[model samples]
Target: PFPSVALVGYTNAGKSTLFNRLTGAEVMAKDLLFATLDTTQRTIRLPQGRPAIIADTVGFVSDLPHELVESFRATLEEVGEADLILHVRDIASPDSAAQAKDVEAVLEQIPTPDGKTRRILEVWNKIDLLEPETRETVVGQAERLAREGTAAAVSAWTGEGIEALRDTIASLIDDDPETQLTVEPHRGDLLAWLYANGRVTGRETDDDGRVHLTVRLHPAALGRLERLYPDVID
Candidate 1:
């Protein structure tokens, strides 16, 4: 499976717009708050030829209601499962900073997998709405995060700074443990499982009915496959 990255932020913070821009999917983006009530997932292809799964979740709010929060636990769990977190913010929003803080608070409440702190890259979004000087200032602030090792800025509507964001995501995902594995034809069940849980790079079937497959899988999947198909791999 493709690695996942979640787009999170306060309601009406342009998270949905950015999600649409990145995934080319239509999942209902509007100017109103809380446009998304559930988690929506789509596939994204990065410039480095690697693919990732992007999840757009319900927008967060300050002092969120317990009922609402409880109802969205499964959706919020998507954030915990993410390989990366794109903290999208509407830079022009007067409460942008406060909104970001609120988002951070909600994220803190979620349980992370493997006890690993979710890697977050703040995205100071909606730059097109800012004045030139303000835009530069915001960019500088976001660049400071990069300097200190954390954030990025972009205008999802205008597609500005998207390339930089994509590149950063590529770098982050590449740093994870990924191994190339080869599979045999008769192991169709294993092959299917690998394709579902890993990224297949190449596959071919020989005249002898053996299959040749190249895949990039997480260490866990690789280990399971090895235990199951010792005779098929090199």
Candidate 2:
């Protein structure tokens, strides 16, 4: 199955801009709230060249009408079905932190399979709206989180860091496959990751410095493996 990602955030967080940048869709981006009342989705190529569906969800508002909630019920359920959730935020907004908390509150209501916490990645977007010094700080914080594989920073309007964001989202999807892949004997790093992230059912090393492995990887780690080291399998 194709992995899916859902974009969710407080209203006017530049999600439409990010959505357009990611999927090449022309969702009308407006400064006004509730501009995107309906959810939109498109298939986009992840950095690893795998295709995944990215959903642009209706933005959340502070005082949403009950009818508005009813209208977006399907979108919220899509969020629940997503393999990854990108919590897009207007990082330059004055109330951004609280806005993030509110978005988090909504995500909390979405039940997950087996009640596991839904995998989420914070998209710290709209850094272009910040002052130079502040932009540096915001991007720096995002890079730190990127190291942990949890967040990304970008100015979706300007296209800055969009590639990295795509890579990060690919790095965060969760899935499992009973599959076979070969690792070169020289690539101990790949072997370690396979062992750490998946259950290895079979292995054999050939004299030509190649190691064959049969493993089951839950998707996120498998994606990282494929993204970072495709040649090992090839």
Candidate 3:
């Protein structure tokens, strides 16, 4: 499986817009509430050429009904299984902070298989709607979060600050132990899997009919591919 990042936030927070921007997928990103009710998964190519699975989930709401939350189990499960969480927030909204808190509360209820919470990267989005002074304040807060090692900022609508966010995510994913892998050409399927799950950095073909490939992939995917193609790696 490819490394996954979950786009989560309160309704109308631009999570879906950001999802479309990052993945280049055409999911419905309306300004209305609950525009996205189910989890939508799309393959995204990072700036570094690495592949990641980006999932856009239903927006979280304060005082949301238990049944409503439960109905999104399959969608929420993506969060539990993700390697990173993009906590998208509407920086322009007056209740943005409160909405973020609501999202956090919902995230708290997601159960992971290893009993460990996913890494969350707070993303203050929609800066295009903020005034100059408020934008400065919001940008300062985002910088502070970066300094404190917690979050980042971006304008999904205008594509501002997106490069920084992508770089940050790339760094985080690179730190994961599961993403390092080596492959040889004999394992065509493993090569395909690597291409799907990670970025292929280098490849060379030897005179002896062997192909060598260097890839950075999620650990789970690497392990599974290795088992399927034991002779692929030297």
Candidate 4:
């Protein structure tokens, strides 16, 4: 399975807009509550042609009903299974911090499959709405957050700070394991995937027409490569 990301946040935090911005998939990104009721996913290609699946989930609200909870089991499950979680926040909202707590309250109920603390990257969305003074503060905070791979400030609407956001996401999820593998000349498809999904440090073609490659890949990508071409590594 591809590495996965889930977008979770309070209603009208611009999570859906950010989702569309990242994945280039047009799902409902309206101002209405619960505009994205179901979990929608699309493949997102990162800076190096590495791909991951990103899911846009239903927006969270304060005091969600128990009955409403049952209706969103799938969305909850999808969030639980994510390799990374982007907690989108409406930075311009007066109650943004409180809303973040509300969303976290619900997230605490959903157990991750691995029983480890989930890696959540805070996304400060709708920065375009911030006043100039407030924007300066948020930008400073974002820069600090970016250093730790913990947060990003962006206006998904204007596409501002998106490239930086992508770089942050890549860094946060990187496994960075390097490997050596040889590919038969016949399996050029596998060769292409390795170059796309990984950093190829060395390459050589033998008289036998096999391509030897020294590559650094994320663990998830490496596992997928191994599964896709079992003979390459041996």
Which candidate number has the best TM-score?
4
TM-score of 4: 0.87
- For model 1, residues 32-80, the per-residue Cα lDDT tens digits are 6678988898887786456788999999889777677778899998998
- RMSD values for the candidates in order, in angstroms, are 4.4, 7.7, 3.2, 2.7
Quantify all predictions' global Cα lDDT against the true fold: 0.81, 0.81, 0.80, 0.86
The TM-score that candidate 3 achieves is: 0.82
Best by lDDT: 4
Candidate 4 stretches greater than 4 Å from native: 184-186, 195-212, 216-231
- lDDT tens digits, residue span 73-156, model 4: 878988988889999999999999999999998887777887655899999999999999999999899999789888999999
Per-residue lDDT tens digits for candidate 3, residues 5-56, read 8899998899998998887788998877788988898877776687777889
Model 1 regions more than 4 Å off: 147-149, 178-216, 220-234
**Candidate 3 Cα outliers beyond 4 Å, as residue runs:** 147-149, 176-196, 201-214, 224-232
Candidate 2 structure quality by residue, lDDT tens digits, 1-234: 467889899989999999999988899998877788778989887653456789898888775555666677877888988888899999999999999988887776666767556788999998889999999998998999998878899999999999998878766763456678887667788887776556566778888978888776666766777788776664
TM-score of predicted model 2?
A: 0.73
User: What is the lDDT for 232 in model 3?
Assistant: 55
- Rank candidates by lDDT, best first: 4, 2, 1, 3
